[model samples]
Target: MKKTLAVALALALTATACGSSDEQDDKSEFAENGTFVYAIPADPGELDPANAVLGATNTVLAFAYDTLVYSDADGKIVSGLAEKWEAQADKVTFTLRKGVTCADKSPVTPQTVADSMNYLSDPKNKAALLGVLIPAGMTATADEAAGTVTLATKDPNPFLLESMTAVYVVCGEGLKDRSILKDKTSGTGMYPLFTSVANDHYAFKARADYAWGPGGAKHEAGMPAAVQLKVVKDESTAANMMTTGELNGAQFTGADRKRVEAIPGVRKGSAPDGIGEFFFHQGDGRAAAENKVRGALVRALDLNELRAIASGGDPVPATRLISLAPDPCRGDSVTGNTPPADPGTAATLLDETGWKAGTDGVRTKGGEKLKLRVAYQTSAGPGVQAGMEYIAQKWKALGVETELVGSADAKYADSLFKDGDWDMAWVPLGLSLPTQLVGYLSGPGPDEQGSNFAHIRNPGYEQLTAEAAKKVGASGCEQWTNAEAALVENVDVVPVLRPTQLVASKNAMLEVIGGVVRPTSVRMLKN
Candidate 1:
């Protein structure tokens, strides 16, 4: 009787296993053997990971391209194509993993990696990270036989490894022809671009032979075969699509955040939001060039009230630019550096600066009314614009007249670089490390082809950053912190909210890995 009962139990277990397998197979028939869906707010027409500036484009490119180094969930540097690396005082060498191939099945030799480095190193190429991620004076050489790429640096780059994590490697074909990449990305990533429908969707086919994942991660068998990105601008529309079982995942921000979270099946995926604030123009000619007025501008707004509206939730006051996990030089740099918001003080400062309030309550100096043009970016959405309007109102209340302008992105860039018509503008600058801020800190003005948008030329801040650049790792954290302090103390930058990353998933189908979505993390789970 005991032996018969045991046999019955064994049969039951086998039947359960078979039933589970059948269920997965049935689901696979839906969309290209299970498609991982990503809902985007705006259409990132075509992904170009190498020069990605916006957060939306970077998310799409993350799956389509593989960087030289990987930062794990903890933001710890891990291996990618370069399986192993050695960093010395003057040089850093990486050993390219063997058998790695680009999306076109072309061998990713050491020479290919070296060629990518040489391409970006050229100033003419106008790579976004010209002086930021990629160090200024560096030459890359490859030994195909040894499967190694060597970078000999002219200056000591403390955050060299961290900066390298942002650079995605491309094969020679894509390197020579950038137009090919502009339409479709051909990279050493797991997914290759299959089709892109303008403003609709971007479909990708997974490479079964993919081997190189972050930290030597292997492509699991049950991973999604195809991933599709559906661009839905309206947050409510995206939430509706998720509830209707169309998309696997979506990111909802600002006012639409609560509505998306209310849906029963949606799961919230959170990551530390990037720090954002208005950086004052410090160029010699601008009205904001005066340190006192810049300080007054920051003080005029009611930040506590503004935070409630500007940010989706209770605003998390930003302490640093990159607050993501395992972030080097972690501390409260924003707290002490930022001055308390005082409207009364703002009025007094303007008065002290020879700009006295007239009968109309608008401050005036000499023959000119103290009027400032404030440009808010269109990409920040309606919520940020609403908040900026309130801040402008408060500025008006504080005696200074403000001309609020809703400038489109390209036009705003022109204002900073070409037109030079504005006194103040809102720009969201984000980076994973303090070292990356160096290029923006001390460089030629925007018109001069440098990232100094405000054309700030600060000798003291420049000196501090230059000294910080020489030391490696945590050794230079204090110097970097002090440099940021110099900017904040002088009111060059107004540190505001650290907006949280909001990723909403349908039926918990997809997950955010290492603060962003990746191909390896997507899987066909039982609903």
Candidate 2:
């Protein structure tokens, strides 16, 4: 679960370009058949949807696989593999669209979708999206005659249908032999894997016969004949490539954003990546285990300054946990809910909590010096590094000895969950639905195969979320907002900033849904 969260977080940080639909309606402005080339930060190692945990892997998977359901730009559930779906508290039923076929020309049956769901639901498979997308202990039953797949969960899931949008259904053959999926595509998507060159590029050829898409969208004249995702690690290089027409689309977040935006023919857009949040380790034997200590830690640092530094001077105050597009609940749960930045108050709180400053300026409680290990992902770039350093300096002034631990994306999850080496971490868990975050904010720890890495045990949060789960979809948003406020008020997690990621495109217009390029939304324009 830690690895899964880490990989998903990487997806949130890396931005992708999208375009408007104004030019999409004109068939004369469209290119009949041409390859659409784009940029990805890293090579998606394995192509298997079930085993994919890296953002790069998921990015590639999105091109080759189609989910059970599709989430439109407005966060509405639309047609995909399943034309229509009915979601209940503990049960969800999907009616499979007729005449759907996999990459191998195999028929995509209700049983096929059921098998994929059951595979992820089973803990023995060890798929990364087990509890994240597919609910834990979920079972699926297929009614082939009715062309429907029914899912049953042990506990009620309010966003059951919305969650299905993330589950990429695997075909029967791929389910039997998972190794073929490592580098090949097998789902009923618009494209199939054509070629894969590790660390270089992964190419996909569009399925001309394909007609079913989100909201019954079909492969038309403007759609690309093939899609190529090139691995370009440097943001500047990607931006430069976009300028020269070498790449059709690419996302830039660093200093290269200005360069990409300056391109004459390129179309640019922005999307909310996620919140720059801080999570305190509430595990036993940790100083942050105390609520007052957590509050003091939050109060010690100037969040506004840190937000500016972290977002590279483009800071947006985060209100809710669901920052990504098509967010079901858009209410503000952050304002007036967290502790304000006040060094004096922080010192006083720490002193009141029995921590007294010594001659060396480091506070001590019961002969133990106040020390903290702050961990953050190095791949988050220089801005995050500066932000983490800024927090350390502020804590140092507050008489707290702080050690900054910078880990790469791959090792960040282990540092937080497996090793339990850090006292606090700056890892943003982004999701479209607030119900999806319930597990991460409160629940079992890593040892119990749960995503609550911080080991946060807030009764108020748990109770509010429990009630929120009972309500269906956005109707429970008010309770969900209050639930998030509980975490903020308790200092369980501090959402500091919401950063906007920029993406530029040339000769192509694409739509970014849930922070990824929607394949069906790609329209190659005539240059």
My TM-score estimates for the predictions, one after another, are 0.85, 0.93
The weakest ten consecutive residues by lDDT in model 2 span: 15-24
lDDT of each: 0.69, 0.83
Error of 1 at 169 (Å): 1.7
Per-residue lDDT tens digits of candidate 2, residues 175-244? 7798888788888788888998999999999987787778877888789999999999988889879878
Candidate 2 global lDDT: 0.83
Candidate 1 residue spans exceeding 4 A from truth: 1-33, 46-57, 123-132, 172-179, 323-327, 447-450, 508-516
The true-versus-predicted C-alpha distance at residue 239 of model 1, in Å, is: 1.7
Q: 237-309 in candidate 1: lDDT tens per residue?
A: 8878877889878766656677777776566655555555777777775668888888888888767677766
Clashing pairs in 1: none
